[model samples]
Target: MQRRKYLKGMATAAGIVTVSSTGNAQVWDSDELSKGEEPKNPSPPRKGDSVMGLTDQIDTVNVGIIGLGNRGFSMTQLIDAMAPDKGVIKAICDIREKPVEEMSDWIKEEGKNDPPATYSGSKNSWRKLVQRDDLDLVFVFTPHQAHTPMAEYAMKKGKHVAVEVPAATTIQECWTLVDTAEKTQKQCVMLENVCYFDIEMWVLNMVRQGVFGDKLTYASGGYIHNLVAEYFFEAYWKDWRSKNHRKYKGDLYPTHGLGPIAFYMGINRGDRLEYIASQESPETQLTERAKELPEDHWAHGADDWANGDTTRSEILTEQDRQIHLQFDVKTNRGYSRKNELAGVDAYHEGFPSQLAVDSEGHGFVDDATYDQYYEEYRHPLWVQMEEIAEEYGGHGGGDFLEIYRLFDAFNDGRPPDMDVYDAAAWSAVRPLSATSIEYGGIPVKFPDFTRGDWQNKRKLQVMDFDTI
Candidate 1:
């Protein structure tokens, strides 16, 4: 099937219009909107081709996962669910004993005969896991600080590494991972979950098909739901939150909001991140609330730290594209995580939440007004996501697709959807954004992690659905 045919019936209010085909750029009307459900088409070649092709070329690429925390466990579950035809999980490691034991038991209980060998001990146990010659790829899911060291170790050991978000905590570490990957000729991918979201993938498909005209500018959005009190009170990583709360406070988690935008904008591949400036709200209600807790409470000491407020980071690309990224743990007592994207050329399409591309020639507005308009113009990805959620079922089904792609890449010897440079560019934003906060909201230049050859990088591989 042609790429453009997949975008049929994608329209939304607020002038968020998407091109219908490669040759014909038509604004889809409300009548084109999918109502009940959309049919599942064949898999795209770029999506599954590389991995499928590589499976026969290479033998099994043994996988190892480090840091079996919440995210780590989720990743392991997804890997287990992959059709055995792809790859197998060979090892698992974590400092926390409980998760390691639990994951091992779960693997055994499920009768997955190829269950990964479990490793757990002191914080330094990660080195042992990376040194294993039996492993082909290692997934680093530890905290922000450990991303660099673990990645470096894995790369040097001739193992491909897939680190969790914020690939590195500092600029130096960022370069270390990139340089090591280049030196070792091994892949190091930052597992930015948002990049694999079905909605994001669909939008990428639209962009590849030129459904959105020469993309002008796009915006990335994020909102912190500080509903989890544990983040502030729990003694996580030597109580790091309470200890350094004041030192590094802005945009603590920027990858989820920035990853999709970077991929869609071709950051590193076509466009480069020029600079970033972040502004944080002076008052932190959440921090103040933590202070009021009794001294006996686990996080009572956290109150003595920094205030809990909102911070917004605006990054500009070399191509002059602007990405408005907002991060906040303070909310008016509610649950919310908002991610939105805006483009000058194409209409809007979003799922798992409301999104619309204005087709009436009207401009964009705030979420409230956008929602009012979205009721009129809606994209088919909304309904499609529900079915996707059911089948894949990780991080709204995006997780499963990501793992599937990873295993396929190993099998086919093709680069992943989000490659080494893509990982560095997106994950590096966290520390780079933090620098702005350190400098009192000043604009900071984002390092070209690719050492300035980002523009000449290979074009992203697209999954050819017809061949599948």
Candidate 2:
């Protein structure tokens, strides 16, 4: 594959060029991928990068999982269904006893292996589980607050870490994971399943192949799912998604929207986030809903619903690319990811499915043409693994695919596709957006979790991860 260059001038200064127009959308592109000039490749493996990619080759990975909430149970079920041959659940930890027992029993019921030691009954019980030496990989599916600390501790204990998204809730924690992963050489990957989503990865394959002209300029997405019912349901917990409405603001969960776009744009690989500015919609929707609740209801109380009903953040990269992110959890509207990608002569947009200009700047493609595109551009990894992935299940089999690749990478003596730098970078969006939101949409710079190494060394190597 050819080394790609940064679209610094193109992304920053290129004006929109109108090629031709369809019904509602315009035929416009800024820079085509193949038209860009090549830049020199950065040195391979910068300092402190020895531990950044793949771990030392290992045999079967032994697993210890923490948290048995919604995501936790799903992961447990995934392992139960798919990972028996590749790894063992050596230990399990969850604050909730019921799910833990259920998982332990499920593992045993399947007769895959011996039932693992289980931990519950206390908040600190996970620490004990982490201390065990038998665990080769510690999976953290706990609440948002525990992600960083648990991952840090597990890496220190000589275990690779696979935690749920936003690997850290704070910038300092992002730094902690970065520094820790460098010292430990134990992999820390945020299980961002969206990166493996069917449609997303299809677009990623096209982007990587430079199908859409390489001088990439803009990308946008959203986490706009209506959660009114989930928020007001009687069983809602403070630690989960429900109560977060009344707490912090600014895209609380950003990795889903950011992950795929960043990959397509080579963020943290060649480009870096320069600064961020965010603005939030009013918190009126949640408050209006609270009006109908009884006085004793949690929503009727004085909790601080600091988060806006919707937030849109504009982020600029050092390479001059632009990213527009949206967050709208409080609305009554259905879920949508307003995913859009644009370059010199090709672009895409969404309300439902996207209408994209073909790679050769031919014309706009509508939803009716999606099947042919899917047939042509589906990621090769998905082509090979989607069958088994669908059987194991998760966000359109993304969960199974990611887990499969993790194990495959380990057995193959290579790093899994996602590393600690990617984890921390994607995870930091929430807290960073929070800081930017609080100060009236001021420009806040994101930390370089890879230090300065991202400038030269970190290129996306998808072919290395091209197996199940």
Candidate 3:
């Protein structure tokens, strides 16, 4: 009560400045201040048993794809690279007809016996694709808001779902995914390709081998990229990316930075995110750029930019480990996932890639030593799939590696490397941090989607590469 009062007083003193659609500043209702209060974490009415090691082996994964944009189209090509042995694209969908038809032709050209069935020209056309009894797996590469609904519907239809990053936008959607996946006994995997990057995998191998030493306590990572042109222009189908900036505050996109760190730290495996607090820089860069658009541009009328130029969130784990995450896309900077991990004996930071051991001085090792570490500790999966992944080509081959692992697990009738709990836990950062920032950086509790099952120690399925 007192904190809310203080925040209200501050808002009143500062006049609660809110931007109108025409880029004019105006006073907003103080009632909006109450939005930051911690929401009730209610258990779902329908309970489902834990799917910790669930498996449904498939002879071959018959795949259906929704959303044929840049990411979706690229994924089709990657799936084609796997072909009839591992999987096949049975059907494809999009809101527009051209891409669907074009992709079908491309797949036909790739020497498949039959072209994939196409669904398009309707917003809800994806439903028909998911309802198909032939599909064993459905890939959702749609817009952010559609991820949860499509994934849930697919799971309920008895098909496993693989969705793009930040699998959900809200906490409710996160729970919906968890519950649906559990009840239906279908996999709900978030396609976080960064988790499969060669450098990230090497680090995972080192951590598993105890090279980072015991009681690893702290780590930090972030997504820093210059997407101004893509976000502001017509790069998106309907400028949905920028609309999110105008509709929400705090870390809008978080999984790219958080996913690999979660794996390194064993999130939802041994430890889980307990709570998060965040602070965001004032909204300046995006709003200023929005004003520069011509009057006829869609963004010309968009004045209320809710997200900030940068957002920093801190998380505490159940084991008292600390994690830091950052989200930024407006700034002009080289792309980085800022992957960093620190333990008692050593430290590692990516994006220029550095590694340090506990020597007398304790600094980054020499170039030769770094090269040796890469040679010695390179993850087995990377060693096995590097050539093929490179040939397939997506995000330095991480994308192809991720798909290969997913299908490998399916073929072997083993649980996936990532599961529904992981999808929920990692994507929960977006809403949790937004609430923290809204309530003046108050710490917000994270719902343990695992329902106390995370304490059972288990190996990450991806690390079990001996089968390869």
Candidate 4:
């Protein structure tokens, strides 16, 4: 009612209690916000008929990978540099037989005349490499609760997928990855490599050329990287991310600060998020820094440590926009991904990165002018994938320009600019920020995985650089 009494009278005139873990001070009127729920993702036999758009091209693809430790053996060396042109690694799984014999000796030191068929035996040998018939796509670097049931069993066993990231962990596994990519129409994607970072696509091409004239409201990032001892031996596999930081509490690794601010806040396409509040920040050094390691370290015998080495969450959109994110993966911090963007005129307080504008009203935009706004708004897919994504070094080339613009938007047939409704609304910010920080932070709402087709969809246009 009356915008929740004008946001609780502007947080009680600044005493600032916008609800953050406490007795969750009721408030949510309007019949519980009209019983929210429309952000899509929830059909599967709402009668098979599922297809959404585009999705069909192939042209040599063939790939298949399923966790050979660390992002499916670095995406099988990006399909061994796209197997002598284009694609083909055909198969490779890993219940771990020494990373399936070191990815079969890197496919015989990349001399593949047609090699790759390995599968470290059952744990559902990636269901026989996604029922391959000479594959087409399957990727899925497993273990995020096995990304939406292994990408809904490789798009219902017809292939074409691409897991990793909170591709699905709830929101009913993101509506079972949107009813199995719409009843097997295929194409899944969600490997959200920081929405193909290149200075966050030049702050999303300077807010799509308006140069932040106003309205793009807010966004602030943070995956404050400090994976203490980098990746704690990937929580010794069977222990998966330290038993999900001892069974979640909040933002347990939100998609690299919620995927480049949900791709510059184009959210599903028009804007969605709606509600979500979170808090956390207390649970000092994950189990006292895992008892200072060395118990033959396999996450040094994990114990109760329900996340929040620092959580932050906060988001709301349906046009009013606003965001916050941040989730410090147990810190001593070093890698910062905090890129803020709050426009009315301009604002960008990111990791030592700044930007002010409104004609420098109060001034502040200088980190030596970020290479002059990266040579004036680069992003033509970083001028053709920054020399092959800085030779495949994740992030500084966002995992090879998010796998070559997701396999050139799936071999040019389109439909894959991160789909399945942006992987269930950006992996439903880790189970709605752990049920709004265990009901004490309040306001959760968010679903519209684009059922109403994101009010006209089509924006966030990455890659179309004159047909590459």
Off by over 4 Å in 4: 1-10, 13-57, 68-89, 98-138, 145-161, 168-188, 191-237, 245-247, 251-267, 278-412, 417-421, 431-456, 459-468
Best by lDDT: 3
What's the lDDT for candidate 1?
A: 0.63
Q: Which window of 10 residues has the lowest lDDT sum in candidate 1?
A: 43-52
Model 4 residue-pair collision total: 6
Top candidate by TM-score: 3
Runs of candidate 1 with Cα error greater than 4 angstroms are 1-57, 233-246, 304-308, 333-338, 347-389, 462-468
lDDT of 1 by residue, 13-63 (tens): 211122111111222243543332322212112211111111213456677
For TM-score, candidate 1 versus 4, the one ahead is 1
Give TM per candidate: 0.77, 0.86, 0.90, 0.33
What would you estimate as the lDDT of candidate 2?
A: 0.75
Query: Local error of candidate 2 at 365, Å?
Result: 1.5
lDDT of 2 at 56: 60
Q: Following a full C-alpha superposition, what root-mean-square deviation does model 2 have from the true structure?
A: 9.0
lDDT of each: 0.63, 0.75, 0.84, 0.71
Candidate with better TM-score, 3 vs 4: 3
Which window of ten consecutive residues has the lowest lDDT sum in model 4? 14-23
Candidate 3, residues 1-468, lDDT tens digits: the string is 554554455344322332211222233344654455323243555467788899988988899999999889998888887778988889999999999998998989888527888999998899999999999999999889999999999999999999998899888888889889889988999999999999999999899888898878898989999877777667752747877888888788899888988998899988988767789998777677768888988777566888988999988787878899999998878998888999877789998999998546568999999999889999998887788889888988999988988988899899999999999889888887887777677666677788888998898888886766
lDDT of 2 by residue, 65-120 (tens): 99988888888878765456677788999887898899898888888768899999
